[model samples]
Target: PIPGWTLERLHKGYGQALQETEVFYDSQTDHQRLRVFDNPRFGRVMTLDGVVQVTEADNFIYHEMLTHVPILAHGAARRVLIVGGGDGGMAREALRHASAEEVTMVEIDAGVVEFCKTYLPGISQGAFDDPRLNLVIDDGAAFMRNTQKKYDVIVIDSTDPVGPGEVLFTDSFYGHAKRALTEGGILVTQNGVPFVQGEELTNSMRAFKALFADWGCYLATVPTYAGGPMAFGWGTDGPGRAVTLAELEARAAAAGLSTEYYTPEVHKAAFALPGYVRRLM
Candidate 1:
């Protein structure tokens, strides 16, 4: 362990610490305590209320899987909705697809967006300035509950199911998200690491199972997110999950995506959950 490492005590009796080489911003936002710092291995790191949110390195795994899987599977998702993700990473990836004509992101904390844009510009990569992105600084749950607008894909790039993010994991929120989707649309959420936060995945899966015809989760390994592989909840009323490998290959080719982590094969294999993670769902 490093002598002056910042400890993140997200779970009881377990924690992850990183040595901060340079602290850029550490202050309380209107919603939570937000911090941005640089680590030797992880590059720039951002945390919300003491929990790791995104790192300069390895955010590609989480952001790519969360956004591309649904968009590629849907094949023609013109309008996408992102709940939370004030850092703009989700919007960044979602807008990569030319098929996504409009990407609407609702974030509760404007401070998070501003701080990340300044401190972690590489993560969002100029997605905030894109004409296709409509950024809304508001409570994500409230927006979902009232929005009459429909999306072909909805990505819940939220924090863990705690504090302000707690409302986003409720049955009511999932119900609203389902209603906000177009026919055959897909919804994905951040369900945490199943090894430690098993209950979180199970609870979200339960809500999804009740609301959608198909519900499950996919795995992605984010080194900053400790314990084990993190799970992203998947739910939709259509055949998105059953997209053939050849079709996915064709779509990937068509999109002309230059990615570091995402591929059609990996996307398919991510859903092949291990027994321990499967048990959680």
Candidate 2:
């Protein structure tokens, strides 16, 4: 607390005390029109895809794991639906499976999609240019209700239950998602970190369980997100739906996806819950 020392210098020195970070790049997406920022340590950083999404440092691991695991578990998946993945990164992974014939992406915000396509090319890469991807700028719930066709897998890659995505976590939405899937189809949604928000996780799981025959709440580590640990809920209408790492790895090998974070060894490990977490269910 010196007279001449500015607050900016104090903050900068405090940050340097723990770690000095810099924003290498940032821009506004032309699609859904959200801001995208990237730093050196946290790769492919913040993306406000309609609701200040992905502020954490390590977004890739969480994004990749959430979209891929269920698709792999379904095994014979061909057509897929990704709700709220405006960055198109999920579409990139969805099409990685040779069995995946088509991927329909439904994003509520067109501005976010456009901005990512133009600015955050590192995450989406050349995904938008791919012929297999059909990008729709619309409400995912409405899209699910209107489509007559069914999909092998449905992934809910949305932000927290607030603003544009509040409806996504509702019971009715889960019921709608159930109808959008084929018989024995698998559904996965991004829940928040259970450790930080235990009640939210429990409530969301209870809602999904009411609509499905079986459910699994698993954990993943993403340094960029809040709490550094995140959770995902896999809801299915059949018992014994959990896929072991051995199974997922064999499938990944056949498909030939050189993934950075997801591996068969990590798959089983991810689902292994701690004692307190087991108590919550």
Candidate 3:
């Protein structure tokens, strides 16, 4: 009574994400995986053109932490830009700042944006419908080089450094990103897994250091991401001082911002690293 699953365990274990979804398994290597969600529940999940981008329904955890942390850290943000999040989840979070004057969402895929707007509305939640947003369906790299306007915060919601999104992980991109920010402006991006992409992590951090005088990589635990953990690198022209739990709480309260995951306690603790991770630098 199963569809194309000759192996019952594959169907049973990954069954939740594969429901009403197509699972494309790799024949050659242990790395290839993709699941396309066709039904109208959480949203459609599309992997990379080569590798699987999202394998589970719970990928939102990684998305959420990546987009919001840098914004909140800036205290009061007035303008924002999100490069390559066609799904609109990052846009939704970026708009949470009441002080945010305008948000420009530049996504490369019209198909992904349309699909997410139609089916994956839960994660994005009608963000495309917001008046504060200006949607541009185009390549993020080209947009970065061309735009003269600066922003208070920029969130790079790109996939891994694969294929079309590869240029996003380069020093050239970081150079443009530094120019795109205003004085004391900050930029944050999905830095990939600490376990699998450690050298990548170091290079990213070093790149940020070259671009901005004050820059660092911070982490959060998102189970569905990579190995139940994920990291995001932040680039800033300002100082990187430690902000305490109570201090963040007071600021959020004073600013009257509503938050579910990022609190002062969580924010302070998210930067905590183990011994091996400590040795990564």
Best by lDDT: 1
Per residue, candidate 3 scores C-alpha lDDT tens digits across 171-275 of: 988889889998878888887777766776787887887887777767876543435366787888764335555666767787676755667666667777776
Candidate 2 regions with alpha-carbon error over 4 angstroms: 1-33, 49-52, 55-57
Pick by TM-score: which candidate is best?
A: 1
Native-to-model Cα distance after best TM-score fit, residue 260 in candidate 2, in Å:
0.9
Candidates, ranked, lDDT: 1, 2, 3
Every candidate's lDDT:
0.94, 0.71, 0.68
Using lDDT as the yardstick, the better of models 2 and 3 is: 2
Estimate, for each residue in 54-146, the C-alpha lDDT of model 1 and write its tens digit. 998889999999999999999999999999999989999998999899999999999999999999999899999999999999999999999
Worst 10 residues of 3 by lDDT: 6-15
Q: 200 in model 1: Cα distance from truth in Å?
A: 0.3
Candidate 2, 85-175: lDDT as tens digits: 8877788788788788888899988877766666577667788888888889888878877888888899999877655777888888888
Model 3 TM-score (2 dp): 0.82
Q: What's the CA RMSD for each of the models? A: 1.0, 5.3, 5.6
